[model samples]
Structure formats: structure tokens, C-alpha cells
Target: MEIDAIATAHAKRLSVADALLPTPPNWDAAAGTELSVRDGVALATRSRVDAGSPEALWRPLTEYRLNVRLGGADPGAAFGALLTEWDQLLEESEASDWDSAAVVTRPSRDTVGTSELLRRGFAPTRVLAVRPADRLAGGPPEVPGVRIRHAEPSELNTLVRLQLELRNYDEQFGVLTRRTDEERALTSATRELLADADSALPSLWIAELYGKPLGFVQVEVPPAAGWADSYVAAGSAGYLASMHVAEEARSSGVGSALAAHAHQLFDEAGMQAVLLHHTLANPRSTPFWYAQGYRPLWTSWYRRPAVQG
Candidate 1:
């Protein structure tokens, strides 16, 4: 195990490139160690080396996985090297008393090389792609007695409540990714954003059927350069942060209505494209977005080894 800093400039570059690529444990950045496994697999496990108790390199791997958040690094060569090294190390380590081993990696075009890691000897794994949804060229369904309008300050709480219930976001990604206080803060922040007069900021759109709240969609304005740069650089445009519809209203064209309304807003604004990520693991969303005509631009995988495998 090599915990010390890498001497070679390229090795250091690998570390920086890894850092640049978005991973889960972002703010928890810390000093990392390069450890050797059974068959010469070199695993780079990181820890908050500056914290009070910085555990050993293999400690977290044994207990729980540290998620990788893909930022903007080209995983083509760096990730391939990481996987190859780890595979070699694992083969050598399997003969020892060690029960299991795993490595964090982003999925690439070469699915064959990735699958071989399991065939050759790695344990249980997964490949999840984060799919983005885009708007279609059309208008929403004309639900009788339903009208779309700009969200008002008075409807802020209602919007939050509807979003919590309709999207099941609170359970799906919110609770897992945010604390109770964080959720409350997010709700308030959205309301404040609605009241702001910044033209470059995102806008919140509301849908009402027979004077009742049907759903809402939020669109960030002026466009984000970091995330949408690739799509936008090639002439793609806009962003859809969050969209939700009431439970009873879903599948009744309300979701499409909200999306179409957003498309109208984008078209009016002269933007051509919109981008937003959805968890492929989510059942309701996978098909919903597909029906809306949004295709995947890229996919990110989450891999974990079984306890005994």
C-alpha cells in the first residue's frame, strides 16, 4: 500500500483528474492512499486524513462504499488504468485471508472490458446511467377548465407540499441526499427564488386544473455553463431543474402539460434545448421521460461488491 504522495507528475495528474470527475463524497475531501491487493491490484481509497480519526485505506471498503460523483474528467484512460490495476491486485489478494474486494469506477463505451472484471474475479457490481430529459416541440394537452399561470408567493407552501407528495422526491432522492433542515431550507430557497427579480435566474411555472394545483416545473435561466456546456457548446440549450405533478393528476396529461408549458417558456426565450438528470433506477421517471422524447446523453454506474463475493 502506497499512502504517500505519488512522485511521478502523471500520477499526481491522475489524482487531480479523479478529483475533477464528479463523485459522491465531494465535500468530504481528504488525503488518499494507494493500497496493494492480492494480485497486485492498486486501490486508491481516500479518507479525511485531516480529521480526528483517519481510518486505514481498506476500512471503508470493508464496511461501506464511498460514492463517486462524476464531475467533468475524461474517465476513458484514467478509469481504465484504475480498474486494471485493482483487478490485478484483487487476483493476488484472493488467495490470502481477505474475503472480498472492490473498486469505484465510471462506465465507459467499453462494456466488454468492464464485464470482464466480474468474469475474471470481482464480486457483485452495477452500472447505472444518469439519463437527462429534454422537451418536445409541441404544446400541452388542453385539459378542460385547466389553465397554466405564473407561480405566486402565496402558493409557495402548496407547491412544496405538492412536490413532496407527487414526485415522491422526498423519499427517492431528497431524504437520502438531504437532511430535514436541508429540505426545509430548499423549500424556502425556492420560494425566495420565485420572488427575486433577477432575469437571469430560473423561473417557477404552475399548472392549475379547475382552479386546483395540478403541478409545477422550475427552469434555471441564463443557462449553467459547467453542466450543460457540452450540449450547449454544440448548440443545445436551457435546463429543467425539477418537475412534479400531483398524484391524482399524473398520467392524465398533467405531467406533459407542465413539460409542454416549460417548452413554451423555453421557445419564447429563444432557447432550443433543455437538460436535466434522472435516476435510471427510479421506476416512474424512466418511462415518463422516455415518453416525453428525452434520450440519454451519458450514463453513470454505481458498483458495490457483495459481502462474501
Candidate 2:
């Protein structure tokens, strides 16, 4: 592996991209089966992620990933060649309809190669959005007859159902790929976590109307934000892990109220920013999140089954 070369290339790209991407991770121990393109002018890795893995529960049944390192010269050409090779491999592999080929890249400078990606049927389906923390903090948005409060331990079933509904809605955009048993596994995990007396859970709140829970949002603050703390360029960050609104309650101000509440909490926690992932194809959420002060920090490109080309 040309670790130094790859790192230097990536750092150079980010430095000139004019985006808010964070420092690149060390390339020496990047996981996957390493491969080269254009005689190592470009590098990549292939990894087959199985659905049975714990992390894969929220991923596609199979993800034959070909992650690229277009850190070399003419990244546009490098990406094109690397993807062509990956497509050829997809043609020979036995794959399920649910399987997908995934690529995650910065949208600013990496847009140079994405035209080829789009031509081959890849979709920019997901975005990592960031909301800066210096904004004014206020109490929850007021909606007549609506109450916003922390979720009770007994509302576990309702909470799980709402989350599943969220996953179902997001999956239509081809981003939340997962197995039929995802709900089963997720429920068990949630149950175990809730039952643990010492477990530090994220702050979860529910919106209720007429005493019936109708929506919910979840947030993880610094020191416990897991991966989010490292993804930002500076200071502590908070993660808006998940949010969902009941179908019967869409456009009833439930979502906006929940978002305002979450922002207040994020501000109080002293977060430098709040991060989240949302499907770009969702007409409703795409604009809603934008109105809530979030903008794209990274766009994840994907082509399902890898055989579409």
C-alpha cells in the first residue's frame, strides 16, 4: 500500500475542495482487499459485507463494496477506470436483488468523477448534513394540544415501532438497505439496552397529541457521540441519530417541533455542530431538514446490485 502517497493525495484534495470535511483517517490500516488502477496511479479496496454481521443488520443483504482512493493524478479518470473494473466483477458475481455497490466521497471536489458514476446508474441517495451550533436556542415550537417530553421506559414498544417506520420510509430511497429480520434484531438490542441499569442511553423524546405518542427524535451528545465526535473538523459534535413521525401526523407541525426541541438540547449540550444522515430522494425530509438549518457535508453515492450498468 502506498500509504504516504494515498494520504498525501487525500489531504491535498480536501485542502482545495472548499468543503467542511474533516482530516482524513490514516490510510495504513484501511480495511479491505487492496487493488490498484492505472498501474497504481489510483488505488481501491473490495470488501463483501454480509448481512449476517451485527453492523450489516442495517445494511444491504450484501454490499460488494469497491471503495476508491482517487488520491492520485487525474482523479476523474482514476475513478472511471476503478469503477469499470468493479462493474465487471459485479457482472460475474451471483448477487441478490437487495445487494448494492457503495461509494462514499466528498461532494465538493469529488464531483469531478461523479459524472461517470451517474452515467453508470449510481444515485446520490444519502447525505451527511451538519447544523452549526452557534444559532439561537429557544424552547420547543408550540403546537396547540401537543406535548413534547422525554420518552418513558414503558414506551419501548411504541418507540421501536416509530423507529421501524422511519427505517421503512428511508429504505425506499435505497439507503437503509437491511434484511427482513432487522426489526427483530433491533428490538432485541433495544430491549437489552433499556434493561441494563447502567447503560448510558441517548436523549430520546416523544411528541404526543391528545395523550397519544405521534413522533420522536433521538440525540447523542459529546463524549458519548461515538463516531460523530470524529467526523467534524473542530470542537465537540452531537449526532441526531434518528427521528420519525407517524404517517397520520405528517405536516401537522410535529416534526418541526421535535427538531426545534432537539436543537435546543444540542445548544445546551455545548455542541459545536449537530450531524445527521438523511435520504436525498425523500421529497419531504430533504426540504424539511434544509429549513431546519442543515446542509450537506458529504454525499454518499451508490448503485445497487453493482450490475445496473
Candidate 3:
């Protein structure tokens, strides 16, 4: 397929993503074989495989998408280091005779290597933050009738409902309101990551008020490779992968409570700083994140309709 032909169309479809992140519509990665966008940065590359082992299927998910990892025969490859050098990889992919494939990265302050990727011409897609230590030191103000607890498997439906409701998407990517499939994906990814101690630790936290689930945040610790780095080893950082608060619960301190809980959990685990990502398209998240002590680390995204076609 001519990537250019799909570039604009892809961007339009991805516009929905902007609701959650500051992302573009499409990007040209492998000279012009494929298109990708994460937080508005689109990348193009040739398809690497039309069909492959489970591991191969997962490569794309983990390499460039936000969905959690999958279990079963899927490959659970780690892109931690590869992401730091994405531009170089893109160059190599372009030079190689291999089939093309595109990948995207969302906004996140923990992505310190993004600036380098931008210098290599990867493109800017989103704005994100790394929260400072002591940012969430104060205990959360009590929400009457609300209780914070470790979510049980039975609560997965409630958790997923709250997750989708907060996003205003009764469905995503054609999936129905019922998220048994998505929940499986999350569980599979979490399980795979956990079974492999070297992989990043995935912690899923949810908030409930009076038997009603409100919101949640899924935080992932650095993968094993990050453990050796002085920056990470020094108890310097924790990553907030995704956070959401339901509309009904917004302005009700549910978010702050969840955030404070995340902060405390990370702090107790020895992280001195907390990092996260936000979509520039979301007017509310940026300001709220800022108030919570986050700052931009780098910007990345693909070509949107707003940019030159």
C-alpha cells in the first residue's frame, strides 16, 4: 500500500486518539511502507510480517502501542533500550531490505532519550511530565463512603467500565462496552511482565467510593535493563503509565486520592521521582498534571491534518 495514500486517512482515524493524548494522524517510517502514530507522531515502515508467531504479533504492541502485553504464544520482547535509540533503528529499517512496519510512542517524562530521537528527525508528538519527589506527600483527603483497596479479579468488570466511561468511549477500536477481551489483554500483559522478574513491574491501582468504582492508574516500573542505570538504581524514578478518573468523580478528589496513593506506593518502593505522559489534546490533563508537579521531557508525534501533508 502507498503509505502516502493512507497517511491522511490514517491521521483522521487517529484523531480520536487526541481525546486522550496530543497525537498526530500518521507518519512515514520505512521510506513509505507503513504509517504509525502515538500521541500524534506518525511513523511509516514496511510490514515486517503479515502473519507470525505470537511473539511476532506482540512485537508491535510492545514496540509502539499502548495496549498491554499478551500472554500465550505471543512474543514479549522488551523495547526499553531500543526506544532510546529509535531513530537509529528507523534508519536501519529504512536501509534494510526487510518488509516495513511502523511504531509509535506516547508522551511520557520517563522517556529521557526522546530528545535524541527528535534530533534524528523522528518528529514531535506529545507533551508529558516527570513528577518531582514530595509532590504527593500529603495524604489524600478522605472521600466519605469511599474505600481504597487492592482490586480483586471479580472487580475487573467494574474497573474496565470506569476506565472506558472516564474516556467517554463506550467502546474503543471497535470493541464493545464489554471489555472481557481488553481485560484479558491487560491481564496477559501484566502476567507476562510479572512472571519475568526482569521485566517492568506492573501495578494496577483503582479507587472506589461507596461500592462504586471511580478511577484507576496503571504504573509500570522500569524493566530489568533500567535497574542497572544509575538514574534508576539511585531510587530516582517511577513511571505512571496511564491514569483516569471517571467524569462523575472528577473534581471530587478521586483523582488526587488515586494519585497520592500512586505516589505513596512508588515512594515506599524507593522511587524518589515519578514520571508520566499526557496528551496535549486533552486540555484538562496537562494543567492537572502540572499542578501535580510534572514537567515536559520531550515532544513526539506524527503528521496530523494540521501539519503539511
Candidate 4:
């Protein structure tokens, strides 16, 4: 198909989808500004890296993202054509030594894109969730000897250690990809937080028992360009960037206490909702986040190793 025709079709499909969304995305602008022809289909690509890691040897990654509208006169055929083109692109990427690729879509009960991705070996890797800040206003559950407080600058090393523990837990479920010089990466992240005084980076909360930190939760204002921001009204969203509780502290209310404290912070800041992403493959994360009042808004579909065929 011609590139102009493909772009027009994709734009129409996106407009239909956007009208159904709980919060309409700026698809018109995105289609006009970022749309391009690839393998005879309209699409876009973005290159990214695990910049938080300190390792120098790791390579950058690329995402061959498609924002095309799926349905048409013959929806199945249209989807099949796009998938065939995508497979060709993937083969080219493997030959070029690309490390990985990914796609993001709004969660839907059934769609041509979702079905085709599943048949092509893609799997759901992450789920983005959102909840109103007012829903988070209840007092934190109490646990004896457990207290939640802002992390002190003197305890930077301790915070890093706790984050490393969280990383270890996430690694088990393939949630984390970048693994290089963790201490250095974590130290850099901590320093960045400290340097951003106007933001909530300093609002890192520690769940402690007798002056020893057992778990932590970090909240921050979402970036203007983030996917979550599209769904949130201006100045009404906070990102729950990270939350972790020690294994021994699990089911003991430490996690709840930390979450409650985070809610309090967002509430005080006048945020109307909180947004976060978690790996669906993690057994612990799915149920826990649901219990905390989060619901999925978007799903990330992925394929790893970028193998050539």
C-alpha cells in the first residue's frame, strides 16, 4: 500500500480507538507528527538505553513501535499484512545485532493487534495501572515496631542497598533487563534524587523497625511526555516509581504502611491519581497492586533475544 494511504487508514483507526478510551490520547497529533512508512506500513521507532546502569559495554536497544489502526474492510487481512512486514523488520534487526524490541498498546478485551502479537510469540511483560489519589487517603495499617519516614541523606547507602534487594526480586520474573554495576547506578540515581530539590525525589519513605530500614517506597511527579501523563489531567498525577518490602516483612503490614505514606504525600500535593507499572509475570506484584487499588491501563508486549529466522 502507498505510505499516504497507510497513514490515513491508521489515523482513522486511532480516532475510533481514542474516542472509546476513558481518557482520549492525542492520537491526531501523534499520527501527523511521528507517522512514517516502514516495510510498506505506517509506523515509528524509538531508540533507548539503560542509562541508569554504569556499565560501559552494554549496547543501546530499539523499539519498532507501531501505532497503526487495526480494523478495516478486511480486518484480518490488514493485520496479517502488517505482521508479515513486522517479521521482515525483525529479521533485519537481528542481522544488524539489535538486542531487543518491544510494543505498547492500550489494554483491550480483543483486538487484531493483540491476537497477532500473541501468535507471533510476543508476551505481555508489563502492566501500567492508575488510581485516584482520593482513593488512597485512608490511614496506613499499623504494625508494631514499624515506622515510615523520609529517607535521610546520611542513609543513601542504605537506600541503595534496599533498592538492590528490590532489583533482585524483580529479576526473578524478567522484569529488569539492565544489570551492570548496580552500586554505581544506584548511587548515581540517589544523587540525582538529592539534586532535584523542588521535586518529590527527596520524598523517599523508609519502613523501619528500631532504626533499621526493612522496606521503602518512592514517589515522583510523572514526566510531561510519559504515557501515564496522557491519561491524567494537568497537575493531578503522581508516579509511584518504586516500592519494596523485605521478605521477612511481607504480610506484616510494612508494605501497606509504606504505600499509605506514599498516598498521603500525593494527597498533600493535590494529585488526583497515582500511576505505576509492574511486571505481570511476577506472582507477588499482580495481586499486591490489585489489593492496593490499581487497575491496568496499558500493557507492554515484548519479544526478547531478537533472534533471526
Give the least accurate 10-residue stretch of model 1, judged by summed lDDT: 49-58
Candidate 4 per-residue lDDT, tens place, 1-309, comes to 565555465546545644323433335444322432332343545455554534321223545565554434555466656666666765655534434555645444325556777777777887777767678545777778899887777778878888888777776554364456767878887767655667644557789975678898888864632445565444568889889888877887888788888877777877777888888888987888889887776677766544434
Instruction: Give per-residue CA lDDT, model 3, range 1-309, as digits (tens).
Output: 233433353334334423222233222244543222222222333333222333332222212222111112111122223333344445453333222223344433324344544543345445545665675646766777656665555666666565545435422211112333444555455445334434334366668867778887777555532532322223456788667877788887888777777777776667766667565556677788887777764344432211111
Which candidate model has the greater TM-score, 1 or 3?
1
The CA-based lDDT of model 2 is what?
A: 0.73
lDDT of 4: 0.65
Q: Using lDDT as the measure, what is the rank order of every candidate, best first?
A: 2, 4, 1, 3
Clashes of each: 21, 0, 31, 1
Segments of candidate 1 deviating more than 4 angstroms: 1-81, 84-135, 166-175, 200-202, 224-226, 230-233, 304-309
Which window of 10 residues has the lowest lDDT sum in candidate 3? Answer: 67-76
The local lDDT score (0 to 100) that residue 285 gets in candidate 2 is 90
TM-score winner between 3 and 4, please give it.
Answer: 4
Question: How well does each candidate superpose onto the true structure, as a TM-score?
Answer: 0.59, 0.85, 0.52, 0.79
Model 2 regions more than 4 Å off: 1-9, 38-54, 71-73, 89-93, 192-202
**RMSD after CA superposition, every candidate:** 9.6, 3.1, 14.1, 4.5
Local distance difference test, candidate 1 = 0.49
Better of 3 and 4 by lDDT: 4
**Ranking 2 against 3 by lDDT, winner:** 2
Model 3's TM-score against the true structure: 0.52
Alpha-carbon local distance difference test for all models: 0.49, 0.73, 0.48, 0.65
Residue 218 in candidate 2, Cα distance off native in Å: 1.4
